[model samples]
Target: MRLFIRLLLIPGIVGWLLGGCSEKIDPKPATYSQLLTGTDKKSWKIVSYQVLDNGNASSVIPAQSGLDACIADDILTFYADAEHKLEVSQNAIICYPNEPDIYVTDTWTLFNANASLEFYLPVLNGKFPWTIKNLTATVLTIEYYFPDINASYRFTFNSTTTK
Candidate 1:
């Protein structure tokens, strides 16, 4: 009689303990800023850029006569402190390092809930505004609408340079 009662109590106690536990809590979603500058703080490179017109996206791959190979392999680094850098590997002394993995630093900032990505060239001659379309851990897609030209320039970048 005591053994039967013990078995019944054991099951109930086990169930009670299991029921008291809750499901694992998921990690909090990262903020817009954290999404750009990843936890590893790595640099990114532009995979492809397109100029859209009439809803059609045209590839702006810098393979034209004037654009060199190194120009196509630019890296962008964004920091949590609102400081950004554009490493123009084209100017490296080795001419073109195939994928242009050289070091250069420019400036960039996206602040105060504004989606404007004001990027200043290293030479400070020009600063372009690229609106943040989407930003993820692995991909960043921004667009520039030129009303003067009636064109929308969309640039897609990858977290790592696969070229």
Candidate 2:
């Protein structure tokens, strides 16, 4: 009876030790590109736009800057494709009723070691470049300099969807 009990205890201890040695699989961390475009696409909405003077915040959006309230409803989406497509949509409230809901479809590029971005701006009729200040799974911040005004503008966006 003592020998049989020892045999059963040996198998249980061996099994427990084997289970402890098993490897755990963890999901891979997302890359910078993946954070911007998610698996295939990502949508973002403007949270705050700030005017910086000499690296200091001078003014804010809406009341201070007199920015149209409708601008907050706009959605910007980035697609992970060969062209790096971008789409801007006027969501909820349309700033300009005469304009279409889909405001613009343009190509975007990430350069400067993925620290900067360049995209077409229909309003300016030229390519606009911005420095990527910060990017995370839920937030993105970008800065643009206006040489004429001698000021920098920072735009912060909140992620609406990662699809």
Model 1 global lDDT (CA atoms, 0 to 1): 0.63
Query: Which lDDT tens digits does candidate 2 get at residues 1-163?
Result: 7887789988889899999999999999887778888999998887777888866786557422345557667788899988899998888877779988888898788885858888653323467898889989998888888878768877777899988
Off by over 4 Å in 2: 1-27, 59-66, 112-114, 120-126, 147-150
How high is the CA lDDT of each candidate model?
Answer: 0.63, 0.79
Query: Candidate 1, residues 50-126: lDDT per residue as tens digits?
Result: 76987787756532222344544445566555445444444333444554354455666775376767774322236
Give the runs in model 1 whose Cα sits over 4 Å from its true position. 1-26, 54-56, 59-67, 82-103, 112-114, 120-125, 161-163
Pairs that collide in candidate 2 are none
For model 1, name the residue pairs that clash.
Answer: none
Q: After superposition, how far is residue 56 of candidate 2 from its true place, in Å?
A: 2.8
| TM-score for predicted model 1 compared with the true structure | 0.61
Q: Against the true structure, candidate 2 has what lDDT?
A: 0.79
